[model samples]
Target: MLDLAKLASQIPGISQHFQREMTASRQRLERAQVLIRQTHAKQQDLIELHEQWRDRLIFSTATPVEPLDTRVPITPAPYSHSVFATDGSQISPSHHEIAYCYLINIGRVMLHYGQNLHPLLDSVPEVYYKSEDIYVAKQWGIRVEEWMGYRRTVLESEMLAEMACGWVNPPGPHREPNLALVDGSLVYWFLETLPHDARDRLLPPMQAAWSQLQAAKIPMIGYISASRSLEALNFFRLNACPHPTPNCIVNCSDLLDAQMPCQVVSPLRDVTLWAYLLEPGQRGPLWRSHARILNSYEECHRVYFCYVHVGTEIARVEMPAWVAEDSTLLDQALSLMLAQVYKGYGYPISLSEAHNYAVVKAADRVRFFALLEQEMLKAGLRNVGTSYKEARKRGSIA
Candidate 1:
């Protein structure tokens, strides 16, 4: 029961508010676009400003590796290449359930182009029911769902690296290039906000996966669709600041909200900027992220990203420093991504396929618990029972 009539009554007010916001947003976008053009005209000067403010930036900003306005057109993809993608889903332990356990299912795909080998698609599902595994969330001082999310990310990275390592091209001088892709950001931004012990526990294994991929020279990328990241927009704001020293504490501390100079470019996102700047199949210049979490990552594992226009939408694509620094690999990766997007008609096909395998539907969950209960009964654990609330939600009498 949702009250549809009540919700419908609020639609007019919601539309009015949204319309007002859109009107304001359009004005901001117009001003921001003008600033973007002006900034590009003097990108060299902005680079100097970035160098000066790189250390003092209070918000996350992108460091320009290539010139700010540099846009690279998509090149032709390789005749033969392989794309590997991995995605994961989880079932968090619920107190209302019969078992105190959780599960992680990793769906992986290896798609080969212009090769005789068949595509590999499968999922690896693991259940964590041991006492140590079940209570680890409490040990980490976080909610079970939150802990599972972090663990799932780590597992996804490890699984991607494992599959990439096992990939072997057919024997010939014409051995094709292959790359790995994950669905979201390579940088775990939340890690920095966690407790020190938790941070220490998580960072090592994540870095270890990065190391494994790097050592094997397997180029890995993270693709984000409809990204709302503000790193690039924040960079523009830094450049547009009107203070003499551009120091937040010294100059802009007491300024009125209306008097702020960077307000000209405020409330713009990197995706919006790229949509206006990039042509189809073109990628904006790569920029290194100055996110705090990167401080814990190794130098080679530092996250860098660029925006790509896949003909349908602007996507934020991220990679490690190792992939970004190598020109050949970077070019190949960009082309592979574009090809995948073309195949998918907007998003990457491998990722979409992997997601299909990873998703756990409600019916599957019901079957899982039913089987678990049966097994528990076979083991003579008759005390197992579903919580009253859960039972009531499943079936109710009139």
Candidate 2:
């Protein structure tokens, strides 16, 4: 009874402490509820996305739809006998080089080639160059000889084809019935390179060659060696990554090991491979029949081991299994030839896709003659004393 006022004051302090605890507990409960709601929302979102993707994949078709055919009948056949393989290499005074090679049996042949124009100057001008037209003109001037040489090689190849066809169909002097093998694709390269004026002159020869081949019932097929750049692109796509530049070197096996499938644009209605595969034609509806295999382990192996060391660019997109298989066989043949020809010199010979072009560079043409001689020996033909140096002196180029 004497301390009633002090007791009342103590009661307020105790009430305040109780209120503070209640408030904190309530705030914590509300925060926990908010967190739980957010987690559930995230989980639901993930589930929906997973379901959508799973459904799409389950319903999507596995192969491409066949394309309508409008062109003439063209079919591939197996080799019979007497196949001819041809190749060409181009080296400029500036050290920029290219090689094109191919093989043809009695049936079909494919030819391929590549060119690298090394930068004329290592360093660029400091100031911003304003002469666009003039710059282009200058650049063309520098590359004109190379372009001409390449064109000439293609022309020569066509001439060889004509010669082979003439030999096979009706049979000509110093010619026997044999399959003409060119180390390249079709006549597209020549057609693309020829000037409008010169095209008229060039077309007849090419047409004549093709006609002769057709008359002989010889099928023409192109073979392409696996390229690192091509493999890099394939790996990039398989892993849902960006395509690599030509300069990039990648471990192809590692890419396959990832086992990831990319979201590819469906080129046709029904093909998964077609999403990655390249075809021949430019315009019109994409054809499934023309679709070729892309991103195979075997192809990657070949690309890594064979083409990478030789330094080739991946130009064409689609790679057919038949072509790849044939190319490997051709490569083996060329390798055997190289081993036989340059046994002691140790000068490694590399075969190109276009025209089966082989390259062996030296200080002078004497080395070339020796190589030619060796090739003749392997072919069981006598050296006819046709020296490359003599040909050069006479203004007769290869």
Candidate 3:
């Protein structure tokens, strides 16, 4: 028990050292918090600046600074009565698939078919193709063989286009050139897919087909139905934002923010007036008040997406814009027509639901085609008049 006060003094010195260490740690943490806050503020500023630059790139109102041809065809042409429609679908070399169907009102019915011919032999060892022991000529032959497969597929599409052209020329009896409805944008992606040699083979026929159609005064209109996957819609939405005039610096992110999910009409006042009005919770035929407009417009091509509730099943119908104005009679008639076409077919929705809106779903192509085919047939058009045998043959090649 001797010198108790002296021992207590030593303990106080150690305790003071611990306190100082804790104080230093607290100061470092505060400094780090301050740095983080500064970084976050700078990041936000950069994001705003980037958005400004993007808007200007997409929507420039000024007349294109680049020179453009302004020439219009001088000679006017006559028209015909028989309308023809054509639809094309392709399975790519990489197994990707796309389909476009359209009506050509002017030409005779034509069918084209082709396929990629590359044999993907799974059993062949990779070493056989890559071996150093193989001769140079053998390696070259293997490469050539591989390329030939792509060339074959390209040739197939060309052949089909040519076949279509052949059907158009020297009009058949009881059939006159009228109009051609193609189910896509006329941007020539189909032609681009062919090989140079195949393109050369197909170009002349395509040119001849165009000339014949033009001579017949049959207007060719490419109509792209409402495509959710298309970038065009995204761009349109961005350009036509809630603002009366879109600012140049705005991009998709800004547009996305302005859009209301599942709402067809945008917040933009001007656009809201111009575009079709969709009533909330309204469940009826998708093409109300649009049929007469479609039938009356001979040369116009339009696109629209509608949320159609057929009972409990909701379907998003991407189709050509068919309505010019509100017409109750026409709407009723169109609804009747749709009901007739879809009578036996099972709709995804139930009878009790007030409104069933259409939603986009992956792998809905087969159902879409079936509905389209039924509608077209009901509209007094024979699409690809092939019998079971012929269809079977076509299916085999595909």
Candidate 4:
């Protein structure tokens, strides 16, 4: 139902737009070279703005390098490591269907490196329709999908930690050291953006899961691919700033020192920055993020991340403060991640398997509705007809 010919005419304009943007981006990248050549004294100075406006300032970054392209090489994955990954999928409630129902399917995978030849896989689907679940959150102004996503994140973390708790190993060559890999960020980022009252309802259980995982002592990594974070770029701006109160509010061009190299650096991404900095199998120095979501974590469980070139793509690897502080465990974690990357085409194989397991197929959806209708009829309740749009979509050829 699209006008293909009309759409074709706009292609040239879109191409030109891309070309224009590319030219600007190249200029910005050249400016970022400033991060590579700065002195230690310039890199470590505090801005004067911190004295006056203490409320908005968060000084968590500790990366002290110039040309912004710094690197440290890491070893490969160990021979006897295990990686456990979990992912979730959901079917949103459809008012057009016979019942107001939603479903969540969690898929988990455990891949062992040395001793085990076969990887373990599992999928669990939970259906929700309880009055409290559907109505309570909605009454508080949370949408159904929003509430479901929150629950799914909690479940994934809880399950990953619970499994790690049971893992025990005696010291040996094949001693199983479990590494829990989360498909996204360690923190429930959505909660940080919500109103205090809204997040209050969700943060407790999520925090509980994080605490459990930290107690388990297994190294956990949250892999973010094509990460959109600007934390690194923000640091670049801070590094080049020459003001007593170095905030971005002042015109950046005027605020930058004449000797600084970052004047050529545009507002680029951490991924691109690291891509230029890190070699294959290398990771940048760890930096703690002052993300608002981190405040909900247990005092000892703050989250931090570092950039790594996993051969093909530069990714941000996040872990708890506990994991970051443990040098041995941290090494094992990085090694396992690199190994998983090697095993997979590019990403972690365990996460890829878990995602595939969690996906809800279209054919399965059709069968699920049929079963729901049958069950209602068996309960002596008449099945409610679906909406006309849905009915038309399911029109019988016969």
Predictions in order: lDDT: 0.84, 0.33, 0.33, 0.73
Q: How does residue 333 of candidate 2 score in lDDT? A: 32
Which lDDT tens digits does candidate 3 get at residues 293-323?
Answer: 2222233223233333333233333322322
RMSD of each: 2.4, 26.0, 24.2, 4.2
Off by over 4 Å in 4: 39-41, 47-54, 57-70, 169-174, 195-201, 247-264, 396-398
In order of appearance, the predictions have TM-scores of 0.93, 0.32, 0.27, 0.87
State model 1's lDDT: 0.84
* Candidate 2 stretches greater than 4 Å from native: 1-80, 91-142, 171-179, 187-195, 198-204, 227-360, 363-398
lDDT of 4 by residue, 84-133 (tens): 88899888889899889888888988887787567779888889888887
Tell me, by TM-score, which candidate is best.
Answer: 1
Who is ahead in lDDT, 3 or 4? 4
As for TM-score, the candidate ahead, 3 or 4, is: 4
Residue 337 of model 2 has an lDDT of 26
lDDT of 2 by residue, 129-194 (tens): 234411332443434344444444445446556544644656444332233444443324344444
Ten contiguous residues minimizing lDDT sum, candidate 4: 59-68
Candidate 3 segments exceeding 4 Å error: 1-177, 188-212, 223-226, 229-245, 250-398
